[model samples]
Target: MIVHLIDGTYEIFRQYYAPRPGHLDGDGREIGATRGVVQSVFTMLQDGATHLGVATDHVIESFRNNLWPTYKSSAGMDPLLLGQFGWLEDALRALGVAVWPMVDVEADDGLASAAAVAAADPRVEQVVICTPDKDLGQCVGGKVVQLDRRQDKLIDVDGVIEKFGVPAGSIPDWLALVGDTADGFPGLPGFGAKTAATLLARYGHLEDIPADAADWDVTVRGAAKLAATLVAQRENADLFKVIATVRTDAEVGTVDDWHWSGPTAAFPAWCERFGWPRLAQDAAALAAARS
Candidate 1:
């Protein structure tokens, strides 16, 4: 069996910027992103998806914010888009998709957790992490791939190596050195793409790197400054690693618990609230088919 793990936060962002207008359900509840999310999930289900799970950031402020003051916070986000987070999770559950709404942990962490759990199961043949987030790359292992549902891109372990120029294990260190804008932390100055990879490939981690540029063995541009910056901001590199590493300890439930069983009676109420008549019928049909 294949497990398809989706990044619900990314989906919300995608639907918010879509050209389509807002959708109003029977009770006049506005559901723009929620409708888009249901459509995307349905499209995937039509494309032979069996075991599917979606992870959403129930609260945007995760543990990463505590580590770095400049890390991503929802304070600047649009209220309309932020309001849809909960509705999206409810809509997915109504459509029979397993939903993981993370509070302290973010959606990426939940996807990483799901990938780890699925990869360990012998019954799960492939675990498709359905997001383009770079952090999820660390969870890509044998038979586990990252799927960007928007672009229909499937990223495997080789794809991780090809994209980052390092193995999956080195992604955290690479991200630490390179920095991530989405997470809101700027990597060390002069530590661009090539320099970080060569150093990480040589030393395995930032901690093992030589403190002085003169002690370096590998050749790269601006080596002296990059090495100097790394030593000067060793504390920042360690902090970035802490932010980059996705936690797998989230309560995503087991594979059997995540098995799709369609929706219960609450599904129709959700559709009615959102004024999505067609969705109610389609969801009911899918639920009956699975039963």
Candidate 2:
């Protein structure tokens, strides 16, 4: 069995910006993103993904905000995008899809936790983390790979090495050094992508990097300034390391909660509510075929 964990926040964002049009129910309600998720998951299941779980931010504020005041906040996000979170969760559940509504933890944390637990189960052949977020790369193990559903690409341990130029184990350390704008953190001032990759490739971690730029050999420009900045912000670096690391210990109730048993008997009702005659037909057909 291959466990598929999804990042619901990222999906909502993607659907919001996608070329798709807004969806209206028979009652003239908006559920476009919810409808998009349904379409995406159907494609995943039809494309050979078996066991699946989708994690969404029940609330955007998490423990990371306590660590850094400047961390990404859901505050000021577009209202339309924010409005879809609940509708999406409800729609997913109404369709019998497994949903993790994250609160103090996060969507990524749920994916990490599920991946860790599922990977440990000997019956499971592999665990697939489905998201393009770089933070989740830290959880990639030999049996676990990251699959970008949008791009139709699968990245293994070697792909992590190829793109990040560092092993999966060192991704958090590399991210801490390079910082991530998407996560709302600034990395060291002088460090660029190449320089960080080169040093991390050699040293494997931030602490292992030499204190003296004079001893460097990777030939990154302004190595002295980079070295000084790292040394000066050592505490900040460690904090960033903690922030960059995804917690694989979220208290998800159980894997049975995530089994992909297909859509519910209410599929037709849900489709009628959403005004998706085509999806209603597809669900009925898929359910009947499975039966």
Candidate 3:
């Protein structure tokens, strides 16, 4: 069986900004994002996805915030979207999808952990992490792959190299050197994507690179200045690497636990409350057809 792992946070963010009309519940709360995500997953089920899990950031702040003060947080986020995080998790659970509502850790870590667990199972044919997030690149290899639903791209180990210019294992190191604006870390001065990829392609990791540019075998523009900056800010680079690395140790359960049986008995009431009458019928029909 193929295991599908979704980044629920990204899906919510994407759907919030989608061109579709906004939806409001009877209480006048904005629920467009949550509805959109649930509908999308329902469609995935219609397309024959039997085993799946969604990882959501129950609280936007995670352990990374302690490491770097400027790491991404709920600050300045649309309160409408923030308010729906809990609703989304509840709706998915009612729909009978395995939902990982992460508390202290972010959704990315949960996805990485689930991907590792799913990939390790001998019965699993493939593990697909459905997200465009670059941080998930480190988890791509072997039976595990990443699917960017927006771009309709499936990324394997070779695809990671083609896109990042280095192997999948070096993505964290490359992100450390080039810096991730989304994650709020400034890499070593004078480092850009190409520069980091080239250096990392040679050295394979941040610590493996020589402190002196003169000791480096690869030719880069302004190698001496870049090397000096890296040496001076080695601690920060290491910290950034730590931040970039997606932890696979989260307790996301085994592959068998993610199997989709069918929507719960409460799902119809959930759809009625959301005014999505058609969703309940479609879900029931799909469940019956599969059975």
Candidate 4:
């Protein structure tokens, strides 16, 4: 009854830099990361993960780029690493795992959307969003949680509060004030984590905070300056919040559609083409045993 939503983009990046041998196909395409991800997913299946889905960044640039000129893009990324994204999607699909290749929206949005869909299903016991991205923290609550696979960490609602100093609902507001360098947005001036968390803890949201620091109940150092910065950049703060919020309207399918039936017939050919013939054998053996 538990549903696992993976961040394929993160996985590929992680594996690419990990201590491992490089792999190239007949045409000299780099595929070690892709192979590593396939192995990792198979390991997940072997370890009792049932319902699973993976979301990948089909294109690194999203609508957020149009909104902010400095939003993260794939400009400096290694061509070899970037080249494997589509192959990774194809490999996951061949493994019979549902893949959401996000283009207009990023992989994080797809995970958020899938997590929302899975959490709303009555038959689901839990929804695990498998990523360590701070943006995904907004989706953690109740039956839905975020998992850091690399660290074996599980973050629930309480975990979100413990880590971010605010509740899940306040994450966007918190990010807006504190800024997220990963997403390429500089938060309001004079508002660091402690200041943002403290103010947000008291006021709950950006719009709810009093215009004058003297009216605030909490005492923050440089409160007057922070208040002035917030007041001056109110419009920019709102825009930043919009950028921070993960869109749950992405077209991730329902829970039942995410179930892992087994690998497709194309899997063996894909493995051979990718120069991992052992993967073909392993996948077939696993599928046979499971069947």
Candidate 5:
């Protein structure tokens, strides 16, 4: 009844940098991150997750790059980690997990889209978006929630307000004002988290804020300077807001398609190739038990 959507891109990056032993295939290609992701997915399956889907960036550069020239790209990324992106997708598919290998759009878009679709399904009890990414917070509400597996935290609608000091709907506006360095957009000057949150808590959005600082009801420090910056960079802030917004139109297919049916026959061979022969047996045993 619960649908779990994973951020495969984040998992790969997390595992690659994690303090664990490195792994290489017979050809000496790095696959430590791929192996780690497979193990992580298996843990989720073993822990009673039935409906699952993973979203990965098939190409790191998405449409956001075209929107903002400085948006996040694959440049300077560790080749070892980058090389495993495709391999991770293949491994997950071989393990019988639904994989969304995003191309022009980023992985976050796929998660947002899938979360939206799953949340709309009447049969779904809850939709858990498994990522700590702030952008995903916009999708939090009703039956949908964000789960940070690493932090062991669940962020619901109220949790979004508690953490950001603004409601879930105001996340893009907040990010636009405060800036998101990860997404390669600098917001208006003199706007930090507290200032943005405080202002947004009252106005609810960018356009609604009064142009004059004197008209503002909030008590943020440097109100005049902040108001001046907002006036000067209002256009830029709107553009950044567009960049911060996650696209929910990705082709994630139906929620029924996301059910975990167990590993495929190719999974065993794929595991051996990755130098983890025991993973094949473990996966098969788990599949049989679940079946």
Candidate 6:
């Protein structure tokens, strides 16, 4: 069985900004993104996805914000997008799919946890984390992989190496040196992607790198200055690594818990609310066919 873990927050952001028609509820709240996400899930179900779960950030601010003052938050996000977070969770639940609405932790942590759990089960043939977030590279290996649904790309262990120039295990270390602008942490200066990847690919991790450039085994331009910067910002690098690492202990349930059993009785009402009654019929048909 293939287990699919979705980054619901990413999907919401993607759909919200997409240049498509807008939808509004009776209360004048924009809900087009939420509607698009539900339709996308239905499309996945039609394409034979089983035992899938979606992880959503119930709130944009998480424990990471407490750690780093500059971490991404909902401060400047569109109110339309923010308003649909709860609706997305509810819609997924109504679709009979397992939904993990994280409050303290971010959605990435939930995907990591679900991937870990699914990969550990021998019954699962593969665990596909459906997101393009580079932070998730650390979770790609063995039965666990990543799927960028928008691009229709499947990323395995080799894909991680080819893209990042380092192995999957060293992703957090790589991010620490290269810095993730999207995550709001500035990595050490003079360490671009190529430099960070070259060093990480050679030494394997931040701590493994030699303190002195003279002791380096590989040849890299500006090794002396890079080494000095690392030394000066060792504490920041360590903190960034901690922030980049995805937590695998979020409370997502077992593989069996994510199985699709069919929609709930409230599904029809939700479909009507979304002004897409055909979804209700399609869901019922799919359920009947599966049964």
lDDT of 4 by residue, 1-291 (tens): 999999999999999999978888877878989988988988998887889999999999999999888999999999999999999999999988999999999999999999989988999999999999999999999899999999999999999999989999999999999999988999998889988999898889999999999999999999899889989999999999999999999998888898787889899888887777788777777767877
Which window of ten consecutive residues has the lowest lDDT sum in model 3? Answer: 266-275
Residue 69 of model 2: what lDDT?
Answer: 85
lDDT of each: 0.85, 0.83, 0.92, 0.91, 0.93, 0.93
Task: Order candidates by TM-score, high to low.
Answer: 6, 3, 5, 4, 1, 2
Ranking by lDDT: 6, 5, 3, 4, 1, 2
Provide TM-scores for the models. 0.94, 0.94, 0.98, 0.97, 0.98, 0.99
Task: State how far residue 271 of model 3 sits from its true place (Å).
Answer: 1.3
What is the C-alpha RMSD, rounded to one decimal, of candidate 4?
A: 1.2
Compose the digit string of candidate 3's lDDT tens values, residues 1-291. 999999999999999999988898887778889889999999999898999999999999999999998998999998999999999999999899999989899899999999989888999999999999999999999899999999999999999999999999999999998889998888778999999999999999999999999999999999999999999999999999999999988889888889988898888877876789889888888888888
TM-score of 6: 0.99
**How many clashes in candidate 3?**
0
lDDT of 4 at 219: 90
Model 5 TM-score, 2 decimals: 0.98
Off by over 4 Å in 1: 26-29
Model 6: residues with Cα > 4 Å off, grouped in runs: none
Q: Write the per-residue lDDT of candidate 1 for residues 1-291, one digit (tens) a residue.
A: 998888999988998898979876665656778888878887777666778899999999998899999999899898888988989988888777899999999999898888889989999999988889889898887878888766878888888878887788888999999999988998888788788888887887888889887888989888878877887888999989989999999988888877776666677777666666677787667767866
lDDT of candidate 6 over 48-167, digit per residue (tens): 998999999998888989888899899888888898999999998999999999989999999999999999999999999999999999999999999999999999999999999999
How close to the true structure is residue 129 of candidate 5, measured as C-alpha lDDT?
95
Q: Deviation in angstroms for 177 in model 5?
A: 0.7
